[model samples]
Target: MDEVEVVVAHSERATLRVGDVFLKVDGDRARAGVEARAMALAPVPTPEVLWHRPPVLAIAALPGRALAQLGRPSTASPAAWAAAGAAIRTLHDAPLPPWPGRSADDLAAALDVECAWLVADGVLPRDLVARNRRIAEAALRPWTPVFVHGDLQPSHVFVEGERVTGVIDWSEAARGDALFDLALLTLGHREHLGDVLAGYGTGPDLDRDVIRGWWVLRSLLTVRWLAEHGFDPAAPGCEIDVLRARL
Candidate 1:
């Protein structure tokens, strides 16, 4: 019998791996449904769904390693990063999902709440929070909605020798700004931004300021959640460092 390996386990959800299969156990059936639907709609490669039984959704593992992990150097080559960018572009160009993403007002309100908590709780210095908040404001502007993976973290992207094999974790999938996905993909890995943009083919057309804003915005918003979820947001090269980078 194959030993069960815990991939990730938090209050909201957990993922376990048994041999070649991954079982995602999510209490929110609606989110799970979105994941399934998003995977089906995504033009890029996704793991085959073995079966879905209530809280447990089993899927076959893809054929490559993750693009990278937070706070760790990526082993993937520039080509692999570019491949990921290309895959992301394809997804963004696809038909929009039925559901909408968080509106600018909602994001601003959340940012305000999180920023206050960060300072009031002494989680981060006021100056740091203030500066990042200002930087984050750039991302609040209007944007044309597109199909977004919503949580396009580097670890969600998989590659095998310069070829993108698959992307995973689609519960957050919705119609959102394309730059948000690009920002998330390159978070903590700024060195690869050029390569990604090269493949994304945005060239000079991309608004780098907005991407930078998202970097600060996302880091600020996730720090507390990460800490509560048993993750070290202050770890080297993690969310804290990303926010400090703006300083």
Candidate 2:
């Protein structure tokens, strides 16, 4: 019997790889439904959905490895990064999904609550958190929502040579700010930002400040989550470094 390799196991979801198939077991059946629906609607490359049975969905593994992983330097060429950018652009150009994403006011309210917790818990320096909080607020302004991957982490992007072979994890897919996806692709991978932008053909319409703001917001929001999940966001070249760059 082939070993069932655990790809990721968290409280909300778990992924197991057996042979060429990945079985995603989500705690929330609704989330699994969203992922399946998003994959069906996405025009860009995505893993083939083999089958679905309630909380577990089976998908065929993509041909190539992930573009990059968190807390590690990407060996992929600039061209590969650019290809990812192009893939993201294609996704953003698609028609918006039926469901809406979080609103600006909701995000602002959540950020305020999270910031207060960080300060009270002393998870980060109050001044540092305050500065990043201020910067993050720039993203809370109005934006014309478009189709977004929701979670566009480097590890979710599969690349073969200079081409983006596939993208995975679509539960968060929804209509949201386009810059959010751009910021996610470049987060913690600042060196590759220029290359990605080149492929994306980011223009004057692109809000660079908002993109930067999302970076800070994402990092701040995820630190506690990562810590609780047995991952360290404060490690060198990780989320903390991204936040520190603002200083």
Error of 1 at 176 (Å): 0.3
Tens digit per residue, CA lDDT, model 1, 34-69: 999899999999999999887788999999999999
Tens digits of per-residue lDDT for model 2 on 1-247?
8899999998889999999999999999998999999999998999999999989999999988898887789999999999998988888889999998888888888888888888899988999999999899889888888899999999999999999999999999999988899898888888898888888886665877888999999888888888898788988878888899978
Residue 165, candidate 1: C-alpha displacement in angstroms: 0.6
Best by TM-score: 1
CA lDDT, candidate 2, residue 127: 97
lDDT of 2 at 221: 82
The lDDT of each candidate is: 0.93, 0.90
Clashing pairs in model 2? none
Cα-based TM-score, every candidate: 0.98, 0.97
Cα distance off (Å), candidate 1, residue 4: 0.3
